[model samples]
Target chain A: MKVAQILKTCTRRAVLAAGLALGSAVSATAEEVFVYNWADYFPPELFDKFTEETGIRVRLDVYQSNEELAAKLQAGGTGYDVIVPGDYMVQQLAQQGLLQEIDFKTLENFPNVEGPLKFPVFDPERLYSAPYLHGSTGISYDSEKVGELEESWSVFFDPDPALSGQIVALDDELEMYKAAAMYLDIDYCTEDPAEATRILELLEAQKPHLLMYSSGGSIERMAAREVPMHHHWANGPFRVREEAPSWRMLFPKEGVNLWADNFAIPVGAQNVEGAKAFINFMLEPENIAAATNFNGYANSIPASRDFIDESVVNDRGIYPGEDIETRYVGNRLCSVEARDLRNRVWTRVRS
Target chain B: MSNRSAHSYLAIGLPLLALAFLFFGPLLAILAASFTERAPNGGIDWSGPVFDAYTALFYTPDLFGELEPNRAFLSAFSRSLYLATCTTLICLVAAIPMAIYISRRSERTKTLLLLLITIPFWANLLARNYAWILILRANGLLDSALQSIWPGFEGTGLLYSETAILIGLVYSFLPFMVLPIFASAERFDWDLVSASRDLGASVSRTYGKVVLPLLTPGILAGSILVFIPSMGNFITPQLLGGGQDFMLGNLIALQFGASRNWAHGAAIAVGLMIGISLVLLCLRRLGPKGPHLSGGA
Candidate 1:
């Protein structure tokens, strides 16, 4: 009985000590900033560079989509210092009071932003978010396999019999619908159910030819030449070209999706100062250029072009010419009725 | 005795409260949300007690603003049921002989065989599924093997097909079927088989009348274990079947995902739960009346 009593007292004291240690560990966040971003968006070395330049340490986490990021923030107490949101999500998150209003104009390198991207529709005054990387969605194919096909969405939507079961499109509903609408030359986010039916007909017709509706692992898929023709984003083709030089990224005659992911500070961030410092650090031409070189995506700073690799900067797919620039269609948040109608259409197509 | 009775109440009460908080709490929340309305920008709207989500499952407002019978969710549901049934039946057929063989082995050999059967589980399911993709894709392992013998073979035509999805589902759930039947087979009386044969019963009659009836409880439990999860699985279909062959699990997930309709997702989940419960109830009534027939593995 005496030994058991002593053992019980010892365990109780050990538990108290462990609990105290964990409490202190959690509270010891004087120099770390937690960033939530898309997977493979930023290089790991950049965080090390930030830590070397500034005294702040960096902790990073990744998410798959903006919806997941927004949902996490909405649940509250995320403890994220920085978050990367896509174009429309920036506005939605801001309106929902999930983001903090950080004045980017006060940052030293804020003026380096390109004039066109500076006042984006998502954040007009640029008080909440800053553009990180921008890209467009289009068709990617191997020249060796398909032999220089015409640059049109029809090649994918109405594929040749020989090219059947050799195509892939993004799994996202909104982006796919937008591409179809662009191909059909109809307005997107329309309340008209007939327009949605038109999109569904096009999707259902193309489903037989599609190998899959997946967005992840496009770089590896393209590099391996697993699928001859892939509906992909701009950056993926650039990486694919590094392995297979014969690959071509085509900006279809129909308008393509032009999107930018932005950096913003979420509410309840523990390290606001660190987050602001990291944002300002990323704004420099040389730093953002290094990111573009690694991820194969273009940065918003126009002057970063000089620091970018010659192949990437000169490639029309990554940096399109003036004629193709006008065909960029930015994503818009759809109305409730339109969204429901599209959801029903999407169900029908997939079913 | 009174003091011991107080201790018993404490033991049971604490566990029951924990179960209520951890299990039934979320279940009740999902049931309640199924009756609510979806807000414009997603999330649940607490202001409504509507049945629109349930009704929307069978009917849709067409482009002409008229009500039409919607076959989308129903088709996906039927496809899921078909796949789950196929998976359960295939697992059952493949596991019976294997289980009997293992049960007849020596104790040490039985342990090793059981370990080997469970080896696939050490790797993550996602990684295993992706490995299947590499082995089944065009110019992959299967294609290359066939090409060595028949140079005309260009593609396997297995990846992103219904057959590929079935292979994946069977591979994933086969172990669930094996372990349960093995348990029953281990407990089975071999002397009864000997006696029946000595009493002039034929081979089929002896095995059928003696063996199968004893294995029914385990077989029923195994079917439940494999079927319920297979009905709700989206990963195997998404990875192997290319997301083209839609299933009920994927449909429910889409509502919460790109569709941004939580009420519909919750309603579908509630409906699935009810359906599964009814199935279990029916199985319990029809199954033999001795063993507990608990589901696991």
Candidate 2:
């Protein structure tokens, strides 16, 4: 009830209590690591294995969106030992002073993490976060219904009235606004009022022909052929393709929005030792491979290729290519005022 | 005497205090936040009360030009009112006759009918909505059934349309409309109907004059129950309507969550409360006789 409001004012007390809680929790024979991550993010077996080996119970909580996670952490009293934030969000949290510095000396397996994740821009020296999964957001469509569909954001932006009620764009403001900006050849994170108007018009044009704006549920409808084409997130499109093989994911010529989710410890984490142990265990090649195979996202562990699911390993949609570096778009974490302006326009898109 | 007074105080005062702290307390906070200034980091500024957020609802701030009223918020408000009225009307019409029929049933049959009406409530709301999606979508239940009959027939896509949103709304609110109306109908004076018929009133006239008027209080209450919630319900439109739908509830949620504007979200919520209150005030005129014998035998 009133707990949400109380939590906001309880920040200092929670921080002090959690700071004291850390040492006591570690000195205990068995401790509970308060792990918080995305809903359906990791394999259940991973937690069970960690608990069995280390005698530390994994008390996990799931968040559906980064915004929701940010809200809880911002309010404080979350009492989480570990939190997995998306790439941009990790830096966002770090900048907000909400995350603790990662102690790499405690994690021996940190060197095994390679590729773009090694010296990730979000944490250049790997001090704040480590990559959990990397994937690209793009177009996922039914091949049989729309034969020879081009790899373009135009399918979502320049909708055909003939294809009315069969197209969907993601409901995410930050992500889909990027697609709209890319489609119109404009900066996604602009503060210009005229640019906001243009983006609004672009989205409004798609509304008549648009089926729905969704975050995660668009995949279910697309897989069921309820929607012929959807502006989809990377991992969802890959998972949906497995169910409906005729479904294909396309990264446009304008390029794609690649997401890298990372594992980070929040400030005032109560079970730091247990959290570090869990993270180190997760960083192992076999354990990381288990995550990739089960969750259908590419992990950063270099030798994970050997243990990853064969279908996922060979699939073009899952592993686009080695040259994903050229496709990377810098995630510009927009300032609050800029985001407010964009969101004002976004409300117009919904209407 | 003082001890007994203290006992009564504990009995009433404690619960009321708890309720105020738990429910009304938070509601007051939200109402307060609606008038407050937004901090740069998206928290309430708490410096002083400001009408800027309320004005922001209807007008955009402009430095170089005069501010214009926000058309998007107005349009979304109108759309929510329109959809809520539509869902209420459809539910009202379908519920009345069904309630009457159920009320006229034998005791065993009446229980069965009421139970059947409420079976949907047992399932999670989201899962029940998903079941409708599976039933109504292209190549889904209805589509496959049609295909079996016609052989290779492609079905029309319905899941993400306004039509689907209405269907889902009507399905959801049907029982809410029925139970109250059924209770009002079940205890009706059958002798009055006989007297009307015996007095040589025409069959249509007897029902129109006598039966319909008696159900008005229940129908009115049911409509209020259905309409108020439907105005704010974004999930039905989101899931069944394919996220193509934007209701007032989703708009408020967007402000708080993705938009990260607490002051604006609170303003929108206050707007919704005012709208619902206006509608509720209007419904009081329709239900002047008040709900009848709901708690009685």
Candidate 3:
């Protein structure tokens, strides 16, 4: 068939699906929910499952980055019922009055969420958001390329000359500088000028070792052997391993950057009731497990442990032990000075 | 004469008014934005005027602090200039021959050639870039051809490189250069060259002194057409040069994209416009002076 014909058919199917979803949403009288979340964060089947169990139909939109989603919300272009933001962005959005206060009464499974997931610095007292997925930033490498992995951050930062032009680092400012701070055992979000200067020097030193800095699809490149090692989010590397198991992940002994994304209703949502129902439905153990399995990220709810595979739940990479936890630092929203320093440093690194 | 004059005014004035409202008006808004401050958290302040954005750009440290000290702004500007020059040169070289060939052809042949040149315009820019990717990637057709020609040849994956960027820019802007040059070449006077030859001048000298001067107008128009867009292009550099090979257009886009600093982006854009204007002014001053060949024809 011609490409035009294929496109026309695909568009027709999409329009039909949209019409059916709208019809169900209108008939149910349970408000229409519009969710904005990360690309491929939720299982496609879960939306259908929610519609089947509850009469509320959910329309989902996906964003590639937290900054992108935040920009859209700030512009007031997207009318999202629920938005998933990373831990740092949660505070930023709440401060901007973009998020709505969550009603605990509506969330039946709220208590089942782990204790560690609650009382995050970004959303203390759980007033605005609920934890969705948790993961860490760490080194993922081909075992064949870098034999017998040592947990030191030095392997990436000051690698042997042989490994030059074969390493990729995270493009994000917070993650890159935080990794530098971890190597020095200093505060990740330090306001001290001297500490900031030291971090910049360290990054400059590591520049020769890096092939490139990239945020999106760097892990995929790593799997393709374009680069042997990369600083990647936990889930991406794991997903790569499913395709090419020779690639392995290691949490640096110095520390790993932990992050959690949460689902919160935006302040101006038109479908608050439906949003609440969707959130409640997603928090259920089985559905959360489906999301975790599909995306290969650690589920936020402790109840999901029962539904997920024991192997995935027990894996040290996904659920790091207490020692790993001790080293892990959840990225905090930096002060204005620190944020500026980070942006400057990142600009330099990229330039 | 009065009716003809009024008709000409109406024909030109309406389009000029529309252009000023639609194009120049938004461009002025962009210029205004550059003078404003960026808010602490990414957005533009619009509250006060500040030069901090431009100043901050200069102070940003070099990549790896290697050769280029002021790397952020300077490197991007230099890269953009370099790419634009390369693209313009490539277009000039390729367009002259093709335009000459077409101009010398019969009217039917010329029309067919023009139609053929425009066939690629049916495809989207993104699709054309993607098609280049398919041809240029590792293990792609280019690589395969090279490997077959020379045994044990390890192909350089040239898809995301400066060379690839030049190829894309040249391909996209070739027609702009060709159309104008063809217009001038088509009006070439065979009598002048014959007269020069008959006066005992060499073939090369007669062609150079007679044929070259007549093509100057087309060359100027085509250069301006290709150079303007090539300097400000973001997609060609972004897709073909990789993220590491930063360009002025990419930096401007970043100010709008991840940085959320629209004012800075606007400032960069305004700077680019000024740069283009200066180049055009220099060309006009330095260009050759000759009588209009078309008037005699």
Query: TM-score of chain A for each candidate?
Result: 0.88, 0.87, 0.89
lDDT of 2: 0.77
TM-score of 1: 0.91
Q: Calculate DockQ per candidate and list them.
A: 0.50, 0.39, 0.30
* DockQ, cand. 2: 0.39
Model 1 DockQ vs. reference:
0.50
Clashing pairs in 3: none
Tens digits of per-residue lDDT for model 3 on A135-230? Answer: 898888887877886888988888867788667777666788999999988787776767777888899888767755666546446556666788
Model 3: what TM-score?
0.85
Quote the lDDT for A207 in model 1.
92
Pairs that collide, model 2: A212-B244, A213-B243
How well does model 3 score by local distance difference test?
Answer: 0.77
What stretches of model 3 exceed 4 Å from their correct place? A1-30, A103-106, A309-326, B1-25, B54-71, B106-116, B130-141, B157-161, B189-203, B287-297
Q: Per-residue alpha-carbon lDDT of model 1 for B1-297, expressed as tens digits?
A: 699999999999999999999999999988998898877767778896999888877787676568888677788888889999999999999998899899999999999999999999999787798888889988889899999999997777899888999999999999999999898888888899999999999989987899888888778888998999999988888888888888888888887777767888898899888989999988888886545666322
